[model samples]
Target: MGTRHRDEGVTMAERPLVVPNPNDPRLTRRLKGLDQDRQPVLSDVVVERPLTLYLNGQEIVTMMTIGDYPECLAVGYLLNQNMLLAGDRISGIDYDEEVETVVVRTERVTNYEQKLSRKVLTSGCAQGTLFGDVLEKFREVKLDRTAVLHTRWLKTLLREIGTLPSLYLVAGAIHGCALCAGDAVILYMEDVGRHNAVDKIAGYMFLNGIAPHDKIFYTTGRLTSEMVIKTVQMQIPILISRSGVTAWGVELAERAGLTLIGRARGRRFLVLAGSERVIFDADAGEDAGA
Candidate 1:
C-alpha cells in the first residue's frame, strides 16, 4: 500500500494528496528518462474501503481493502482463504460506494473461521498479514517437475503482458497482477494494493473456470508471504515477477515446490525455487545463471 501526508498547518482540503502510480516511468519505462527531475509524479494515496463478504445473509469476513475492483477482491479473498469451493458458489456481489462497503452473496456458508483464526501479522507497508500453517500445507503440493518453460517464451510472455492495459497505466499508483497461459495473458488486474491486485486476478480466474496449474502468475510488485500464499492457493506452480522477494516468501515457495523467478528484467532472471522448470537456451551455454 502507498502512503500520504497532510500538514498540520494546512487544512485537509488545502493539503496536497499524493497518490500511487503503478505505472511510474522509473519502474515501468523501457528507457530511463534524461530529465530525472522532471519525472511524472505518481499518487501515494492508498484507497481504503471495507468489503463485507456474506454467505446467505450472514457476514463472513469484513476486509479492509484498497477498493478498486471490490467484487473481484471479495471473491478472490474468499477463494484464497479457502472459503470458496468454486466460482459458481458466489451468487452475486453488491457494492455500496456511499457506505464504503461491498456485500457478497454466496450459495453456502463456507467454514472460514478456522482459517481466519490463524491470522499471522507481517511487516508489510500495508496492514499485511496471512493465515498461519498455510505454508506447511503447501509442502503437500506435488507439481509436474518436468513442465519446462523455454527462455524465449518467458521473455515473450513478459514483454507482451507488460504492455497490457492496467489501472497502473491510468492511476500510476497501483500494482498489477496477471495470469498467463501459453503465450497469451488471460487476465490482468491492478489496484492500490498488491494483494488486491492478486485477489482480482484470482477471482477472475475462478469465475472463468481457468485451471491454475496450467498458468503462470506474474506481478509488478514484491513477492511477499501473502503473494506466495495466494499463488499456492491457486495451485499455480510457476510465478514470475520483475520485483524482489522476501526471505519467508522464498522459503514458502521452496517448500511448496513452486518455480519462483524474480528480477525478470530484459534477458535475465533469478530462480529462487524449483529451478528445474526453467529450461535455459542451449545456445546460451551451461554457464547461464539460474
Candidate 2:
C-alpha cells in the first residue's frame, strides 16, 4: 500500500528498491539443463509469474512479468492503453507480492470493456499483446520536435548499456529497456516482455514527473508498431534498439517524427527515421574502433 499524494504531486517510492538485478535470487532460479556437451549442468532461468492488475476495483489485465516494479508496470500499462488519462488522480497503489497482483486506485472512475474487446498480437518477444484501440491515439500523438540526439552520445550509450548487468545476460530469457537523458541511464527495467519493460519506464516517468523531451528510450527488442506507438505516447522523441526494425514501425515513427535507430551494436546503427534530429558529432572512423 501507499500513501496519498496531493493532486498535483507524485507518490515517491517509500523504500529504497533495486530492480532488474540479475543476481536477485527471487527473480532467477537455478535449474538443471543439458549443456552443449550434453552433460547435465545447472542453469539460471528468469522467473516469470502472472501479474494481474486492477484499476479502481475492476480487473484490468494479467501480465506475465519477472516480478519487479509491478507498481510501475501496472500504472504504465493503464496509461499506455489509454485507460488512464494525463489528468487522472491516483489516490494510491497496492502491490501484493504473494498474490503477484497490483491495484491502482484512481479518483476518477474508469472502464475499458470495449477497448479490451479488441486485441492485437504484437511483434515483441514473449508474444506481446496490446489493445487495438491504441491505433487512434497513436496517430494523434505528436512527439516534441525539438528533441535531438548526438551521434557521439549514442555510441557511448550503447557501450554502457551492454556493460550493465541484465537478466538477459544472467538467464538469457528476458528483454530490457532503459530511459536515458543525454546518454546517461535514468531508469532500467527488464521483464519477460519488452512491452512490460517499456511500460515500467513509462510508469516511472509518470510518477517521478520526468519529462520526455530530450530523453532517449532504448530497448533490446526490435522496433515494432507497438513499440513505436508506446514510445510516442510516452512523449519520448527518440527510440534506439539493438535489434532491427519492422516496416510498420518505421512508418509510425515517420508519422510521429520520432527518431528511430536500430542495430545499435558496437558503433554501427541505422537511422530509419528523423535523421534530422541527430547530430553526427562523432568522427566516422572512431565509431568503428574499440
| TM-scores, all models, native as reference | 0.74, 0.91
Q: Give the worst 10-residue stretch by lDDT in candidate 1.
A: 1-10
lDDT of 2: 0.84
Q: Write the per-residue lDDT of candidate 1 for residues 166-251, one digit (tens) a residue.
A: 54554466677877765556677766567777878877666645556666888888888778888888788888889999998999
Stretches of candidate 1 off by over 4 Å are: 1-48, 60-66, 86-88, 111-115, 123-125, 282-290
Q: Note the clash tally of each candidate.
A: 12, 0
- Cα RMSDs of all predictions? 12.5, 3.9
What C-alpha lDDT, on a 0 to 100 scale, does residue 27 get in candidate 2? 92
Residue-pair clash count for candidate 1: 12
Q: Largest lDDT belongs to which candidate? A: 2
lDDT of 1: 0.67
